[model samples]
Target: MGIFEYAPAPESRAVVDIKPSYDLFIGGEFVPATGGVFKSVNPATEEVLAEIGLASDADVDRAVAAARTAYERVWSRMPGAERGKYLFRIARIIQERARELAVLESIDNGKPIRETRDVDVPLVAAHFFHYAGWADKLEYAGYGPNPRPLGVAAQVIPWNFPLLMLAWKIAPALACGNTVVLKPAETTPLTALLFAEICRQAELPAGVVNIVTGAGETGARLVAHPGVDKVAFTGSTAVGRSIARAVAGTDKKLTLELGGKAANIVFDDAPIDQAVEGIVDSIFFNQGQVCCAGSRLLVQESIQDELLDALRRRMGTLRLGDPLDKNTDVGAINSAEQLARITELTAAGEAEGAERWSPACELPAQGFWFAPTIFTNVSATHRIAREEIFGPVLSVLTFRTPDEAIAKANNTPYGLSAGVWTEKGSRILSMAKRLRAGVVWANTFNKFDPASPFGGYKESGYGREGGLQGLEAYLDV
Candidate 1:
C-alpha cells in the first residue's frame, strides 16, 4: 500500500516568541557568555530560532560560584516549607504556560507538538508538583531524620525531551534545598531558557537556579568546577564515563543516566493486537529518541511470523512530517549530526545481512528524518541487536523457549529497561524477576511516573532519578 498524504495542520508559531538572541541565566539574570554565542535552529525547517551564548570555563566558574553562594546564603538557609511554596509556584506557572512552552519546545527541539504538549510538558509539571510535596516531608522519606542538602549541584542534560530532562534534574535538586547550575543541551536550550523565565515568575531566589548554555566543553568545565558539590548527567555512556573520571577523587556526589538497548520480548500467548500497539509506542514514541527505547524486539518462534505481519501493518499507519503539526506521529530528528549517526548505524545493519524494512512514508525535503525501520532475522551478535541505535530503528530476533527469550534479552551490557508481553501471569512474574533491567513492563511499555524511581543498571549508568530515591541523590545524611 502507498502512503497517504495529509494537509498541514501546523500549530500556530505565534504561541511562542523567539528572541533574536539569548544569554546565560546566572545569579537570577541573563548575562553574556565569556565564550561566543551559537545559533539554535529548528531541525524541522533548518531555521535559526535563536542565538544562544556558549559557556566558557570562566562562565561555568561564575555560574557555579553563583550556585555556591545561593546554597550557602539563601536556598540552604530557607525553611523546607518555604522551599515547597516556591516549587509549588513553579509548578503552577509551568501549567499556566504549558501551551506556549509546548509550542516553543516543538519548534526548538523538533519533537511533534502532540508530544511536547501531551507528554513532555505534562511530565515536567508533574515532576515539580511531586517533588514540591516532598520538600517539607523529607524528614519522613527514610533518608534520615533531617537529611541535609548537597549544596551546589551541577547538572548537564541531553537534547531529547529537553524540558522534561531539565525538570528531572532540577526539581529534585531544588526540593532537597540544593542550588543548581544546569547546562541544557546546546541544540535545545530555548525551553530551558523559557524555564528561567518561569523561575522569575515563581519568585525563586537569585542564584538558586542558574542555566549556562553550551556543548561538551561547557559541561566539562561545570563538572570539574570546584564549587559544585554534586554532579548529575544524562547523555551518552562515553560522556558519562568521562564525567565519572573527571569527578573521581573529589568529594563531589555524582549520578549518571546514560544509554540503553532495551529488549521487548513477546511470547506466543501474548495478545497480538495489544502487543503490536505497545511495540509501536515503545520505539516510535519520540521518534525513537528515548534512552530506554525498546530497540530490540524478541518474539517467540511460534508467533514470530504473525507478530511481524501485524507490526508491519501498524508501522505503515504512522504519520511523519512537520513537528508543529498536531497530528504528526513521528517528527524530525533533533539535528543533522543525529541524522548522520542514525544513517550510519542503519547502513551497518543492512550490510551485516539483516533484512531491513521500513514503512512507505515520505520524508520532508529539508530537515532530518528517518522512516520507522525494522531489521528482521537479527542475531544477538549483530550491532543492531547489541548496540543502542537511539533512532526509529528496531532489531528483531526470535527465540524458541522462555529460557532462550530471557537469555537473549539479558545478553547486553546495558540493563536500562525491558518489556514482556504474555497472558501467563506466572511467566510474566518469572521473566520480570529474571530481567536485569531497572524497569520491566509486562503487557505494557514506556510508562513513567514521578513517584517511581527511574535509572539503569550496568553501563546504562547509576543512581535513581525519580520518587523518594531521587531525593537521595541530592541529600546528605
Candidate 2:
C-alpha cells in the first residue's frame, strides 16, 4: 500500500509575541541581567528568535537571595491552602494561554506544534493542578506529621521539555512551600520566561519564583550557592555529576534526573501491530529528544523479521519539516550541537558494523534535522546500542528467551526506563521485575502521568520527580 500525501497545515505563529530581547525574571519582576545577553534562535529555520539575558554570578546570587527572602518571609509562611490557590491560578493561566505557549514552544524549541500543543503544554498545566491538590494536604502525603519546607530551592531544567520539566521541579517544590530559583536551559528560555508572566498574572509573590538564564557556569553558580536549601536538576549525566560533586558534604538537599538509553523489549507473543506503533512513538516522539526514549529495540528472535518490516514501514510515513506545521511528525533538532551529536553517533553505528537504515526522506535546506534512523544487526557492544543518542535513532537486537531479553536490556549504564511488549501477563510481570530500569511500561511506551513517580537508578540519577515522593524532595523530613 502507498502512503497518503497531505498538504501543509501550518499552525499560526501569530499567537506568540516574541520580544526582540528578553530580560532575566527576578524577584517577581523582569529585570536586566548583570551579565551579557545571548540570542535564542528558531532551530527550524535558524532564525534569531530573541536575545536573552545571560545571568552572571551576581545574577545567580541575587536570584537565590530573592528566593531565600520569599521563603523565609512570605511563601513558607503562607497557608498550604493559600499556596494551592496560587498554583491553581498558575495552572488556569497556563490553560488560557495554552495556544500562545504552544506556538512559542514550537518556534523556540524546534519541536512539532502537535507535541507542544497537545502533549507538553497540557502536561505542564496538569502537573500544576495535580500538585496544587497536594499543596494543602501535605500531612496526608505520608511524609510524617509536619514536613517543613526546605526554604530556597535551586532548580535547573533541560531544553527537551522546557516548560514541563519546569512544572515537574517547580510544582512539587511550591506545593511543599519551598520558594525556587530556576535556570531554564539557555537554548530554550522563552517558554520559561513566559511562565514568569503566568506567575505574575496569578499574583504570585516576588522572590517566590525567580528564573535566571545562562549556560553551564550560571547553572553551576545557582546550584552551588549556599543560600539554596534544596537543589533539583534534570539534564545530562555529566552535568549531574558536577552538581553532585558541588553539593557533596553541603547541608543542601539534592535530586537529579539525568540521561537514559532505555530498551523497548518486544516478545514473540506480543501483538505485532501494537508493538510497531509503540516502537515508533517510543523513539520518534519529540523527535526522540526524550531522555527515557526507547533508543534500543530488543525483539524476540522468532518474530524479529516480522517486527522490523512493520517498524520500517511506519518510519517511512513520518513527516519531517517545519515545527509550526501540524502535519510534521518529526521536526528540527533542538540545536546544531545536538544535531552534530546525533550525526556522529549514527556514523559510529555504521562504522561499528551495525546495519543502518533510514527511509528516503528529504530534510529541509536550513536548520538542524535528522531523518528517523534505525540500525539492525546491532551487537550489544555497538556504540549505537550502548550510548544515549538522544535523537530519533533506534538500534535493534534480537533475543531468544525472556532471560536473554532481560539481560540485553539491563546491560546499559543507564537505568532510567524500559518497556516490555507481550501478551502473557506473567511474562510481563517477570520481565518488568527483572529489568534494572526505574520505570517499566508493559505493552506501552513513553506514557507519563502527574500522579506517577518518575526517575531512574544507577547513573540515570537519583530520587523521584512526581507523586508523593516528589514532594519529599523539597521537604525537611
Predicted model with the maximum TM-score: 2
Give the Cα error of residue 283 in candidate 2, in Å.
Answer: 0.4
Alpha-carbon TM-score of each model against the true structure: 0.98, 0.99
lDDT of 2 by residue, 101-166 (tens): 999999999999999999999999999999999999999999899999998999999999999999
Q: Which stretches of candidate 1 lie over 4 Å from their true place?
A: 1-7
State the RMSD for candidate 1.
1.2
Task: Give the local distance difference test score of model 1.
Answer: 0.93
lDDT of each prediction vs. the true structure?
A: 0.93, 0.94
Error of 1 at 71 (Å): 1.1
Candidate 2 Cα deviation (angstroms), residue 307: 0.6
What C-alpha lDDT, on a 0 to 100 scale, does residue 239 get in candidate 2?
95
* TM-score of candidate 1 on Cα atoms, chains taken together: 0.98
